[model samples]
Target chain A: MTTERVDDATTLTDDERRTLAAIADRLIPAAHGMPSAADVVTDERLRFALNARPDLAEPLRQALRPELGPDLQARLDTLGADEPATLYALQLVIVGAYYTDAGVRDGIGYPGQVAITVRSWEYPQYLEDGLIDAVLARGPVWRDPATGTRARTDNAPNTYAERFGGTPPEGDTHGHDRA
Target chain B: MASEPADVLIIGAGASGAVVALRLAEAGFKVTCLEQGEWLNRADYPGNKLDWELKARKDWATSPNIRGLASDYPIVEDDTPVSPLMYNAVGGSTIIFAGAWPRALPSDFRVRSLDGIADDWPIDYFELLPYFYRTDKQFGISGLPGDPAYPPDTEDAPMPPLPIGAAGLKVARGMTKLGWHWWPEFNSINSTNYDGRRPCVQRSTCQSGCNEGAKASTDLTHWPKAIGLGATLITGARVSRIEHNDKALATGATWIDRDGAEHFQPAKVVVLAANAIGTPRLLLLSGLGNSSGLVGKRLMMHPFANVAGLFEEPLMSWAGQFGDLIESLEFYETDEKRGFVRGARWGLAPTGGPINTALPSRAGEQAWGPDHHLHVRSHLGHGANWGLFAEDLPDEANHITLSDTVTDASGIPAPEVHYRMSDNSRRMLDFHIERAKESMDAAGAYKIEVDRLMRYSGWHLLGTARMGDDPKTSVVDRWNRSHDVKNLYVVDGSCFVTSSGVNPTSTIVAIALRAADHMVETRFEQQVPA
Candidate 1:
């Protein structure tokens, strides 16, 4: 797995870096053609939102420690091991990154599962751009903080429609993932 | 602090407080308005999805600086059996609402009279109509005039109805075929042009916040006008307590800023428009609610669930306003056939983005994973969904109280919301879902997925600090003034006697405008300015 550094304001240590990757992978395990958890979880936008909520990070870290081992442990050690706030932020970013990723689009089983079939609609194009940015921009993190969790760099729906074509429709009829 | 003592002091710049302030201010008393949320501009609303959804790049520092004087509006394990309460900046809940504005039917105001259950509002639709017309004009609502499914129009909408998509058109046609009384729902959004405000661009992001001034949030309408009229809006200021004199009349208010400093604003009249949950919680926290003991009681929410369908062709769900082109009230009337008094309203809505798309269901679902990947290879693009917004009965047992267990940023107990649906509401929901399924089938849905009743889902909270004739029975009088505290007033959904089946923002604005007129004519001038 090719490791890319997460460009948070401060450069995370090697251990911190490994833990982020592991956490992201666990949140979204790559079992299909979408993309690897490692490839999609690196977005910088996703990392920042995780930092905002420290409480959610602890549960994430607790869930991942046994699976990730030393790389994850060293990151914890670097933060002096007791920083619940730090872990909470990291986990939120990891979960958020995993869920919204195009790979998870099929994994989460969104309706009509078809990717962009609408070649000319006004909105699909932006969704296509967002999908490309999500896939190619690599760190799964939101670039702009003001948009909070929904922030993305490609900010245009046309960009997404142009790139990915359309969302793939799900064959299953039970599409409840709406929060 | 002001130079002289006054009768009431209003806190927070939002839907509820703005209405209360306008009411008392119009009544001829000196009224002061306090807003903790930032005063944003039209430009502040960027037309970007990320910017709209996550509020990305919106200045967290410059945003509403109001801290929860009391933290976390908590939902107790016992009281709020299902949902959570969300806190927002200016405009209160109206800021984040989809602007699916609708008026309450005549029966909604007189629940006790028509249904023979629950208490009746001290006032009714007739009392609110003129004000409704005023606010609809001020807010610039849009719809086809006089659809007849609702009350007759007193004034035409500012803009024409938004164009209905294939799905909406299909639903409308199907409803018409079924002889159902269907019309485009009225909303406080500009479909064309109104009073210098632009119309909606069909961006479908109203729930996130309208970047365009089309949606009628208090921040865009009343609060801005109030500020222009010399109302001092202090953003990020969370009011902690309502200071009173020896006579127990409200004199001023104390709030905490983000920086943890306590600030005080002295006003003659105190209006609480923090919304259904916030208004009551704040009044309780201020120690001004016990006289009536109805500070945080009788909280109600219009519980909404959804039913989604997939057609052979694409519905292009995201092509319009968040919710406008579709409206249904097949189950709106009260009847024993449905085993409920009040009814539910259903609408066809576009699905939210991926993160919000998660739902609870049985197996064979393939939206995610390898099967979903394969499914996407065939069916992914065309999607349309329907929403079920049902009226929940007012259970005095459903309420908001201060929780001893949890606290927010400022160390006050979070408002604990204990809400349980009355059996009548459940029966109404079941009947409505069956009707919704029929509509979907009529619209030619090849495959459909409906949701269970989400009793606690919507944050459209109301009726806790209610308006009634008797102080013993309610928190405020018909004019939305507190019966117990002569000078104190409660606006917002909290003052709602019944949680109407429709969105409450338009009604909230109507009540506020009415109250403003009342205040200007009767109350404000009597107070000697300090």
Candidate 2:
């Protein structure tokens, strides 16, 4: 089902549109207790809103098109009927993909039913789980052993696993128990 | 010369000043208070939605939010730095603050000693506990008696807690699920009836001034009691300079009344309760505190940022005590791993009015458009917004000086606030963001859009004229008496040693109460040499 309305609004290219949808969903992914981020139509609505603010819009569009490729644009252009409905429906699917994508969800720390304040301090065990494999993803407690200081680590667990080439010791690999 | 000389002269009949006047007058000392702002009454408050922009329906000059010595108060500026001063009216900024009256945690009084950040206050919480109790009874605070969260649960609050709304429920559920601590916010507002004031109607416009007289701004709280004691209040008299002897002992002060006519009043003692920014600027500009040279240093602003969550249900933040609930103090303790010296308290702040909710950064264009309207109708109720008020460390760089360009109608240089977050503050913000995001997600928010961190300019601006052990490093001694002026005293947030991450009103009032008693004892009973 799609929204059945038409409005004369600034439009985003399919590539840019998809990227926006992906990021929005990554920030708030779908889960068991809540509606999927895609269901909210945050991306499509944001695009139409940003159309008036070109300074921000142009930068956003430029960032998205590289990942979207030409084929999706051609398909979107041919299938479009009512502008809002077509754009919105397209957004729903892309956002759905963004929410379901495990890697992206993990990168943004999209834990289901998050209690932000408690989680503000990371569970020592979660770091062991390699869930905190990235810097930006690390909460303040994730201290860098070498510097005797705090810094953000990388979110790419596979890259980390590759570099280390071995499973981390039991307590170091999964921070689930600590969480 | 014909003007009568009083035993004590108090400038600005506001919160701290009025309290001092009452205490002094009750002690049989003749007291006169001169206020530069209009003597607005309880009926003057205009409770409206437009208050978000206009700052509680106040005219910029007459408005307590905008009035200050360095800003609205008259001065001839020629590139010299000045600061924004507060109101010179009866009951000063207390006339315009959101009646969030949380007492300073005991750690607040001893932060420098406990955390090794700022200097220790002249007195500790234990010394001021009796005053805190007295003032709480006087103001009729609304809170529960015991929670084991922090301390001396003296008695049940004069009134019951305000009813928590949808926003409160969402925050409480989220916090409970996460095993975080929670409690009702202690407000200097009458939830039921106390001191002849009515209960709150939950108009949720307390910041714009409450017409119901439920929220205890001094106009409704302290003034009536103070006035009943035969104290005379002179409004719209802007204090300009402190007149003293060659010894720098304060004997009198000069001020310009509302008509721009100058009046000099003599007194045996003078009290400066003109708040943090104004108090120091007055001392510095009047050339009365040069011996200490610490009038405008160690300036601290409890810079706060809002971290909100968009929940799955309407939190109708506009409906009640701006969210009656607050979360645990589990994180209120500092840890070395967080790379911060102090801790922050998280609370549920409901900030979703038409203007604030529709921030260009947050709600975006969908705010007014058809989609935006739908989003608001659907998700605005779902607005489960919470915020983190972290304590910013005392950074010498974050000082309030005179602006180079802008000046108010009075020609005083606008207060040029130089504020930049320390690495510690940045780390605190990062931690707060992570927590805010987690709460939003935990509260079943379908989508969460968090605003990036920005400098919070207003929240108990303190420490410009900090109290300390040494004269050179401090403006006022521990008793809030100017080190240079033996008889002049500053009894406001200006005397704060550090800006704790909570509302400073209670602490300020407590300290002022203590100082008043001390002054009485010292002047009449015995003399302690500085």
Candidate 3:
């Protein structure tokens, strides 16, 4: 979303905020028992997202500018098709702001990227669960070429000479299956 | 340098360079490592912070081009879809790696013999066994022994395996239903307190650098011991070229510091431990190690794909380390019947945090409109992705060359990659995606989304400077020594003969250990240009 380097973290004016709110609502309206992007793009939440990713400030400002036109869906459609980068900044803040909301995070039952105390690794229960009894029955899956015994197995490649009775398949050094 | 010449000077103090430096220093040889990027503080890692996901999307992104840090150099990826993902810092790419540390199978060595394709490596898999064991401990690896997917020598990891959390168990069940070969992930991240580093706390922000030091990047595991052993590690020293003589012996290297000041550090021997891309760029710049005209040919980049599945359960898919969950090698070997010459491997990983899950870039479309919240709600803690890492057969076409237009901060020409995924790799990816979707189906996923090809997943860089017995066909010999330059060596992934289906870091470190130790074993016969 933060595409290029910028010297300063630009902020949106009051008119820009209104335009972004209208567009954010179109992008992520209240549906399926979820808060809209406009509902989630609160001052507190936007501030949090911007503080975490200050590089997005200029892109966010550019995405919401009035020069992009008044028809919200038309503006978004044009940006989505042609100016995808600007649209990326728009969605990152709108959607990113929506996800960063505490209520939204709680609704999804995601406590965030919290650290967990990892207990000592016990012997894998899969052994007792009989998950690999069938796998072990299939024997080894790899081919050991260092030892000649393993190389002679059914795992060895059936070469073109072995298959079609010719020299090593030639013509394409890049491994293209030339017809 | 102002001081007398060292016994060995290593360029690029990443995993390989760090290993070589420590071993040479312990053997009482004067060793010095020049790293382009500085030593990073643990606090700089985003894993421990509240805004970790925010950082992951921007400054801490895996692609150096996207991260755009001062230490990063431009890799002109215009010719290919696969973007080269690497860090230029002292820890190298490991700083941003997810730590899936599996050694290449024995068959990866003899591709020509077993698979009738790429040239067989001069050295065999068994030669790297001892070094693998040593490096497993050095990096504080963790896994269960006897995976049955590999040789019995596989696993036997130094520590217990990280927990196969709720998500892992779900995927493991899917593999079980399919009667496929699956194993708990083998990783360089610690499961227990190991070598004075903390155990993995399941922070899951592993790709953004592990702040807890649970992951064994070389900065934590090797550089400290090397420096303590009196090995010099000069950070922000970007090497320009290797200085060689008519005798075909490397004298030293000319490097530019942070202030653009150039200096030549002399050494009896020089080791290029820079990653696959950086090493070839330097070799092209130096105009040495190219007698075979293979200094930057035969590139293997292991094209990647992803299949993310959504389940009804909140599996805490964002809670644990990204990839150290479970892996299935059900189809990792060659299968002629599958319409592909080579095969691919699958590792079950957590779909990351809210920002990553909701990003429009992943789906290649806006996650806006009606499905905006529904998208995040479904994938946040309720989905897992099975990442397919397909073996890209070495092709002269998918090679690296010097870019005439693009340059780094110091005006040095950048490396340009001319990579296009082979027909074999595409078929392999297509085949794996179907199987992965089946696995997801067996796991009772309600919906499955496939990123058919990952454009930015060029993490494993290999085979640019291939190693073989014949000088005419390769850049280095069996022991990773440059055939053209007797006193020079390239021990990074550039020495890879074949790109294995699984991760390459484990093999990269083990090979470096063996080559550096071989130096210790044969120091008496070592030659110097000085």
Retained true contacts (fraction), each candidate: 0.05, 0.00, 0.55
**TM (chain A) per model:** 0.35, 0.28, 0.71
lDDT of 3 by residue, B20-41 (tens): 9999999999998889898888
Worst 10 residues of 1 chain B by lDDT: B60-69
Clashing pairs in 3: none
How many clashes show up per model? 119, 40, 0
Compare the candidates by TM-score and give the number of the best one.
Answer: 3
Residue-by-residue lDDT tens digits, candidate 2, A46-140:
44333322223334444455633445444334434425443433333333333334443353333222111111112223224332233212223
What tens-digit string does per-residue lDDT give for candidate 2 at B1-530? 22688677887777888778878777877788877666665565544322222232123223333333322443222322222334445667765566666766666666666666776676776678788887887776766444334543445566645545567666665655565555567777776566888766666666555667777767667776667876777776677777777666776788765555777888878888877666766676577875755666666655455566666554556556542345445466567687777767666665544324322334233332224334434554456655666776666676656556665444345455565657786688678778777766666767766654533235466887888778877888888887877788888887888777777788888888888988888875422222
- CA lDDT of each prediction against the hidden true structure: 0.59, 0.58, 0.82
Q: What docking class should model 3 receive?
A: acceptable
Cα lDDT of model 1 by residue, B1-530, tens digit = 33343344666676667665554444444556666555555555433333222232122111122112222233444555446434456675566567777787666776667667787777777778888887777777766553434444456665556555666666665665565545556677765555666666666666556767777777766665665554555667777777777676776788777677887777666777777767777788888855677777877787777676666776556556665667776567666666677777776666544433321121224243334333433333345566776777777778777888776566667677677777777777777777777777877777677666654355577888878888778778887777766667676778888887887777877887776566666653433233
CA deviation > 4 Å runs, candidate 2: A1-179, B48-88, B358-368, B402-414, B454-457, B525-530
| Whole-structure CA lDDT of model 1 | 0.59
Over 4 Å off, model 3? A1-10, A146-179, B1-4
Every model: iRMSD:
19.1, 19.4, 11.9
